[model samples]
Target chain A: MDIKEYKKYAENRSKRTSSLKNCVLAFIGGGIICVIGQVLFNLYSIFTIEEHAKLLTSASLIFLAGLFTGIGWFDVLAKIFGGGTLVPITGFANAIAAAAIDNKKEGFIAGVGAKMFIIAGSVIVYGVSFSILYGVAYYFYLLLI
Target chain B: MKNIIKFPEPVSIIQSASVVGKLEHEGPLGQYFDMYEDDIYFGKDSWEKAESEMCRRTLSTLLAKANMKYIDLDLVLAGDLLNQCIASSFGLLDCNAPFLGLYGACSTFAEGVIIGSNLCSTHQIDRCAALASSHFCSSERQFRFPIEYGGQRTPTSQNTVTGCGAFLLECTGYPPYITECVIGRIVDSGIKDQNNMGAAMAPATVDTLMRYFNDSGKSANDFDIISTGDLGKEGYEIACELLYKNRLDMWGKYTDCGMLMYDYKKQDVNSGASGCGCSAAIAASYFIDKLKNGCKDILLIGTGALLSPVSVLQKQNIPAVAHLIHISNSRN
Candidate 1:
């Protein structure tokens, strides 16, 4: 068969991942992480202002994710939770920490320092650019109003 | 003229050994492996070094098991799933033999055997060592995400096996000789998904199998076993169906090293095991034993997807190759 035909044939034969199952798992896993964040936010709010509590909650989650990555638990959790473990502050933290840990053996400069952002670099770049664009757009609208 | 090369005199596989990491040691074919390290690092500081160390141990075990020394080898043909094939070069650094580095992606092991056997059959080398290795951690960092990255594996994705296999081939020795081999040609099936490697590689497997059968005039029933290197589940199924459509029935005699490496029900390996080491370890340990134990003839086709990380990122289609090696118990 031709390449095009073979591609279609292979695609039909290969098993696809269940989107419904993944969505359910992601919903539950992401919900649990958010709940943890909410709990931390509430606990911090008991002793601090709303702004400080938010910052503290983010910090705590980042710390926990980095710790779990170091202990090699983050990957284990990731296998089960899939995208649920991602799309969170903790996931971003885990990505940085994991890259750092993976490259530690190569030393500080070329290894950990340079590659620490390998996975998160694209996210940061796009995220910051989009935010700046939104900020400029919002400023123009405010001036017109 | 056929592309197949038939040896005037069979090159004997004198000895073989396999070394694997913890996950592979816990696999279904765990007991068949010669040695395994509980530590994935193999007591090294990094995953790359760990892979090199695995290769070193595999060669050492092969030599030790054969009651031979490194000095006895005239040439060492080795490769791995590492950049520039550093795993083989650095791992076999201490071996005083002449070395030839090869790159065929996951088909490196079979490529090594084909070249090594050709050299041995031509009486150019008295003894040659063929080696290949791959480590999951190292491969992941280079090809996919970081080891600790929170990413989900697609159902069609395969787990790279952390293992190494070494085969000691001589011009003359015991049975289970390399009688014939066919070097594969690159074939592209327009598969862009890196996660579904099995699908990308299945067409190449079918291409090579068809060529081998057509040229050699051999039927599937003639061999005791016909196995592909690391096609995993999706590729294996696709290959079977494709071959069946072409009127070549490979149902009962067909199997894949990727499928044999792990237990589908128990192991969380989505599609199955892969990597260069997947086939190398299985062929070295399990199939070698089977050949030794009265299995008359066996055909091992090492399948490889030749897509680099850069190429895949650029959205290029994956090109694949499958090399065939005909191993038989008798020279005739």
Candidate 2:
């Protein structure tokens, strides 16, 4: 058989990710994380304003993710949670922290400092560029209105 | 043209030893391994060093089993999955014999056997050692991601085996002899997904197996068992289907080291186990034990995907190779 035909056949035979199972698990996992965030927000709100509570809640989740990653628990959690842990702020923190820990052997400046953003670099770049583009577009619409 | 190399004289595998980690120790063939370490680090500070240490201890165990020392060996051929093959160099540092480092990815162990057997058969060397190793933690950080990275593994992805296997080959000494070998050609199957190594490597397995059958005029029925190293479940099926299409059927007799290394249903490993150590450890322990028993002949085809992280990032298609070795109980 030719390469093209074999490629097509192999693709058909290979195992695929179970989208339905992943979706259900992600819903439950993400829901649990959000519920934790909500509880944190309420506890913080008892001591401060709503804005401060919201900021503190996000900070708390990021810290927890980083701590879990450092302690080697985040990957195990992510394995079962799938996208539940990935689509949250915790995932972003885990990404950076994992990279930093992995590259730590190469020393600080070239290793941890440079490669810390390796995974999240693209996300940051596209996010900032699109936000700037949206800001300029909205400013023009506001002036015309 | 035919690619099979028939040895003029049989090279005997006098002794073989395997060292595996906790997960592998819990596998089906766990009892066959010579040594098992519950600690992934093997008392080392870093993962890279742990891999080197595994290789060092494997060679020592093989030498001990053979009742020989490193100085008694004429040559040592070793390889691993680490960049620059550092594991082999650093691990075998205490060896007092001449050494050659090979880089065949997962197929490195078979590649070493082929070379070592050829040298022994030709009388260029009296005794030679072939060793290969891979640590899951080390290979993961180098090839895919950090162990602590919070990312979901695809169903096609394989878990790298944390183990090492060493073999001692001599011109005359044992029953399980290396009779024939076929050095594989690089075959590009146009597979680009890094996660799907089985698909990338299956075509190479087909190419090598077809060439072996055509060159030797031997069918799948000639061997008691034909095993491929580190192809996992996906590649194993594809190889079987492709070979059947080419008029060579290996349905029942064929199996894979990757598939045999882990229990897919019980273990969290997505497809199965992989890496240089997967084939090496299995070949040295389980298959060698079979040869020692009543098993007549077997064929071990080591399949490997020759793609680096840089090559994958650059969008280069994975090029794979499969090296074949025919090991038999009788010298003839």
- Please name the candidate that would achieve the greatest DockQ relative to the true structure: 1
Question: What stretches of model 1 exceed 4 Å from their correct place?
Answer: none
State the displacement of the C-alpha of residue B254, model 1, in Å, after optimal TM-score superposition.
Answer: 0.7
Assess every candidate by TM-score.
0.98, 0.97
Cα lDDT, all candidates: 0.92, 0.92
DockQ of 2: 0.77
lDDT of candidate 1 over B177-288, digit per residue (tens): 9999989999998999998999999989998999999887889999999999999988998899889988998768999999999989988999999999999999999999
lDDT of 2 by residue, A78-99 (tens): 9999899999999999999999
| Candidate RMSDs in order | 1.1, 1.4
lDDT of 2 at B317: 89
- Per-residue error for B188 in candidate 2, Å, reads 1.1
Candidate 2 — which pairs collide? none
Residue-level lDDT of model 2, residues B1-332, one tens digit each, is 65989999999999999999999999998999999999988998888999999999999999999888888999999999899999999999988789999999999999999999999999999999999999999999999887899888888889999999988999875688999999999999988888889989998998899899988888888888899999888788778777888889886899999999998878888878899999999999999999878789999998889999999999998999999999999877
